[model samples]
Target: MKPAINPNKIVVFTGAGISVSSGLEAFRDSDLRSVGQHEQLASPHAWNRRRKEVIEYYNWRRECAGKAQPTPAHLAIARLEQKYEVVVITQNVDDLHERAGSRDVIHLHGELRKVRCCGQHALVSDIGISPQYLGDTCPDGHELRPHVVWFGEQIMHYSETGRHFKTAAKVLVIGTSLQVDPAAKLPKKGRYRAEKLIVNPHFDVADRPYSYRIIHKEADSIVPDIVAAWLEGQRWDYGLGRA
Candidate 1:
């Protein structure tokens, strides 16, 4: 389905699947580790009981996310800014979208390239996803922790994101199955007149209060086509559901 383009207001909400083609794996999708490993490695329990292991896991994640590159989907979204006022709100912690030249991106899950002091929890530095040893200290002499949000941790940047969602005229969703919060909530409640399009490889496609569902397709394959067509002044005829 082709979506009409409105350069004035567009919000691109992205998820882990957008970066899968780039060689990074979203924790939920990969079979590289057992469920227990993920559970033990990503939670506060791990941080308290297995501090060393926790640090190692996040450091490994940083290395892997760092090696990954932006995919066509990311580039396509970045290019959209040339003709449209675009805001990219992503669930993935990787900086691939920014690396691909997208100017305005909101990392709801936090970023892998930064660290914070464990003392005051103040943002300490942008360490580019490098390994953070257990003894690493910030300027305030506090141990530095991965900036990326962990399971059981609170997500950042909700109010800032909500304002944009309420003001958007077009919302393009990619590669998510409405399993997560706030991210899932954005598409359902937005401006009274916004086009919401969801692109996912696996999802139960059904009509809802605010969006059209496009299923069984990867973002890398479909996003460029949609954005390109939009740039060329063409749109799909979905009739009244064109929000």
Candidate 2:
């Protein structure tokens, strides 16, 4: 179903599936060993302890994410931002959403491009291009660590994300299974005006009790169509802002 075109405030919740079109791998879709290895080696405890393994793992991720670009689906959402107050809450660690010209995106998973100090949560911009070597260090004299959330650790800035959800007029779930915590609860946490919309080809969140519209399709195929339909309803012409 098409969403109400005149939405004042729109919050889009995206996931790794959106990045898969850009040649990135999802942890659940690929071999478990690679995902687990990367997670273990990139964790705070691992980086503080087994520094070499951590650097190598994150360096690989950095290289991969660096080579990837945003998909058409990402661009479509950015276009929506022009007409509606759009705020993206994404689980993907890549900067594709930003590259697509999205203004305000909250990464539930930390970015792969940035680095932080080992002891403190403080991050540094623009750190890795190649695989990070053993001797990487922050300007503050501490070892540089990956800016990613590892297993068994609390998600950074969750309270801020919850606050964003509380203010949303509509919640759009794109390319996510909604199996993960805190993020999984965001749809239900919003006000009654909020309408949930899920778009995914694989598993979906339709079994849940939230008021939602489910579209079983790939992001690249459905997003442009969805946005096209949304735009046609407005008084503005179709090509108002083409990127």
Candidate 1 stretches with Cα past 4 Å from truth are: 1-7, 26-28, 206-209, 213-215, 237-243
lDDT of 1 by residue, 115-216 (tens): 888886585589876678888988778888777677888788888887777777777888777777756776775654565677787866763435564646
Weakest lDDT window of 10 consecutive positions for candidate 1: 234-243
For model 2, how does the per-residue alpha-carbon lDDT over 1-243 read when each residue is reduced to its tens digit?
323433577788898777668877644368586677865675667756887777777777778778877899999989887677888988888889999999999988788888777656575667646566676777777776677788767776677777776777666678888788866776665656665567787854445536666777788877777676555543212233222
lDDT of each: 0.76, 0.72
Error of 1 at 205 (Å): 2.0
Off by over 4 Å in 2: 1-7, 26-28, 31-33, 128-131, 204-206, 233-243
Candidate 1 lands at a TM-score of 0.88
Q: Which candidate has the highest lDDT of all?
A: 1
Which 10 residues in a row give candidate 2 its minimum summed lDDT? 234-243
Global lDDT of model 2: 0.72
